[model samples]
Target: MSIGNTFYQHKDIHKKTWRHPDGRVSNEIDYVCIAKRWRSSLLDVKVHRGADVGSDHHLLIAKFRLRLKRLPPTPQRARPFDVMKLKQPTVATQFQLELRNRFQAPADCEEAEDQWTQFRTTLTKSAEAVVGR
Candidate 1:
């Protein structure tokens, strides 16, 4: 643990945490301690004398900033097909024939999303068979 006030600069009045009963002397006795690893997150530390808790010691305050990390997005599909194989005449013809045969089936899906999903699956399967991933 480490003291937070030592890291920041403040005036004498803002740094003092306690006052003598005679009302003529004050001292910095209270402290805001935190873990050494999280010291960078500690922004500032100060004394709040306005808070009336009926105690000789003033209220101590410590400010901090914490940052959370975001997670990476998940992949939606498998590996992609190597379309470069289609550059050859024989591979392009084979891929075209496969796609034609697969698409020949009637898509009786009522929703547009189902129709698109079926078309995408058929195209991907055909490409996988004709090309290399």
Candidate 2:
């Protein structure tokens, strides 16, 4: 929405030649009249610069409220090529234990490397087991 710098007490006439990097806005119509017309939908309004594109106009920013209804997400049907899980399963107590006791970093470089090597081996095996390839 465009507004005369009067109410805002900020004016920059030189910005008339300025242009926004994003194409979200460009020189447009009056902002005030539009805002008052749809005061409920409009959340906020802002003014922007309009560089001379052979048109003498300033850009405007208008915010609007959008209503969306929440719906429960449904599980999508799996495709043959999809690499996700073949079956949806619940997390078990054993899985939680493995995750909690997985690994710890040591102060020494050699100890850390040993732990990291074991971790990588376990990960590779897990991936291979999942796909059964």
**Measured by C-alpha RMSD in angstroms, how accurate is candidate 2?**
17.8
User: Which ranges in model 2 have alpha carbons more than 4 Å from their true place?
Assistant: 1-29, 32-38, 50-52, 69-133
Model 1, position 131, has a per-residue lDDT of 96
Candidate 2 per-residue lDDT, tens place, 1-133, comes to 4343223323444223233457444333443544444445556555555434453455555556866669999998744322344343432333334444654444454676776887776644544444333
TM-score of model number 2: 0.26
Candidate 1 ranges with C-alpha deviation above 4 Å: 73-133
Q: Residue 22 in candidate 1 has what lDDT?
A: 98
Best model per lDDT:
1
lDDT of 1 by residue, 1-133 (tens): 9889767789999999999999999999999989988888999998999999999999999989976679899877877788788899999999999999888553588888888888888988898888968
In order of appearance, the predictions have TM-scores of: 0.54, 0.26
* N/CA/C clash count, model 2: 2
Best by TM-score: 1
